[model samples]
Target: MQRDRNQIIQAENSLLASYAVRQDETGVREYPEAEHPYRIPLQRDRDRVVHSSAFKRLQYKTQVFVYSVGENYRNRLTHTLEVAGISRTMATALGLNSLLAETIALAHDLGHTPFGHAGQDMLSDLMKDFGGFEHNKQSLRIVTFLETRYPSFPGLNLCGETIKGMMKHGGEYLGSHLGQERKEEGPSLEAQCADVADEIAYTSHDIDDGLEMGYLKLEELSDLHLWSDSFLKVKEEYPDLGGKVLVRSVIRELTNGMVSNMIRTIESRIHQWKISSRADLNFHFQEGKRIATYEPEYWEKVRELKSFLYRTLYRHPSVVVTSDRGRDIIESLFYHFRKQPDSIPETYRQRFETEGLERCVCDFVAGMTDRYAEEMAQSIGFKSKEA
Candidate 1:
């Protein structure tokens, strides 16, 4: 269905991704039964993620606090839901591809290790000799191959478009040492839209979470750089909007500024970097290709917000100490069970014994819950409540 102007991003020319998850019309139609009763193509993407074992395990995965003695803190699952909400809202307003945006947001952290980035870093260090470890690529693996829904397909069989967008964070993928020449090029408009939405969601929500956790005060946050510019004007204009209002106002500004850059870059055609449209994701013009850059001041605002979170929310004493412990728990769990393999879960054991150990170990650690982490730790004598 063609989206209305106010709804999803509509492109008369928006081509489909290089592949699709359930592309075979005949196969989807005859897959043992029935029709999907949804209007959006990504609804299937959403359903698949929701039903997956990995998604359920997100309840134990850390966003900030890990090994929480209580259920009050935000887990990776809650964070993903928040990101989806904000991403959908921003995409709706910008007329970006909301379904694709939501899909990327939903799958962004599926590959995250047991303790989040801390866990990721440890695994990356351990797997340096291998292909290296990254949550984004892991998300793709989970959806496409690891999920056990279909016998014939190795993964959940997601289409190409959503997978592409989920991995392509910017117009490109910038990691450890990959320079301008070799970095995987940027994302489609759909993927780019999701990236922007992720920023908007996490920045605001993390601040809110920090305040709730007593790691930050509202007054202290007002000192952050985002308010140094036109914030007063926006506040006066939308006095009753509160945090929700402030978040939308700030996001709208950032998005508009960024989109303006994208338009200008595309039109000027002095492209130094390649941005993928429907036709090409990695094609760079030697003469007329460039990446979009936002205003420095605007960038400062974003940096300050991120820095504030790094200091007060993510790096806060409570958040850090707990996640540090969480790292030990996951690593210990992985090392111990990875040897026996069969002690973890029947499916995981079979997968490990069959598919090789690393991925199976990934699957086992990825499936644990918060309590399960503690329980495993206690059982292994790595941790004891009495300690």
Candidate 2:
């Protein structure tokens, strides 16, 4: 059951080792190679990610709630863990690489700033010259340079498919779509799973978080097409399956829902557009064609859930105010420092000389825990130590 580099290398046209070559603000991944007797290749990949420092950093980074508000609200780390839980489940059910799915889930947001997307937007504007910025790509960078394991190497040395998801995980922002040619990497089925896995977790957890925070009533949450009734039925029948109990199964069910929806949307769109062949997911190279659809009624319910999260969970006044401030603070910091990375703190400065300024800046930001990043906002001259 044990598979190694030579084994995996022969299985694919190439294994993406270059990503493991970059250094984080700390310099290198500090992992030790171990000979496991019975772990599969992808499983090994998953384990490496969970053990990496960068993966641990996810805890301190942003999720829906800012890190400080509530200990329970998902932080980047918790979010990653949840994503992995659901991903492994899905991957296992589908007979894909459970480890690969889990690895991608854990590393998906490694590049997110201490403040989440708000922080990424700011850095992207500043680093537009340094090929811009991306959390997925940064996740790739984390395993490669910052995590520190392979003495002879810098990154986790993951597979090509894993790296591809890290590179192109979100929106179809093809190279140069936003002004620069996209990284010379293609999409893979694994990345697709990671992307879908994120959606599944976010949709379900945000509601759970909403309920936890007292913003959503269970009745409100369960008001969907069979979804609400089904959730209630499960709660009523199992009783014990309440709270975070069946979260994984719910997410698995949600994945099926979303996938089914996407299938219908694609099919309907194809017919509407007069397109032929089910090649939208061209890279998937699917063999058997299975019919899937998101029931219109269910779609409406999902939309309602999505809207509720946006308005209640994401757009809560307190959260919005802080996130808005977060956006401003991070943007200001990146703009000034991108021009003079030497302005970065001494620990970061010494590191800057090796990786150049932009990356050094990215490392400085990415390395921060939520509280520390907000506190350090002052050193860069973006307002004062006092908010």
> How do all models score by TM-score?
0.72, 0.70
**Over the stretch 39-58, how does candidate 1's per-residue lDDT look in tens digits?**
33456666777888888888
Cα lDDT, model 1, residue 50: 80
Predicted model with the maximum TM-score: 1
RMSD of each: 6.7, 8.0
Error of 2 at 135 (Å): 1.0
> Per-residue CA lDDT of candidate 2, range 1-387, in tens?
756555543443133222111111111113344534444345556777878877777787778778777898888887787778766665454434555567778778877787887777777777788767777667666766666676666778654445554655234444422212113223333445566668767887776676677776656555655356446545665767755566545544655566556545534644554433223333222422222224567667777777877876788777777778787777666656777776677766876667677778877776677777777676655673236
Q: Which window of 10 residues has the lowest lDDT sum in candidate 1?
A: 20-29
How far residue 119's Cα lies from its native spot in candidate 1, in Å, is: 2.2
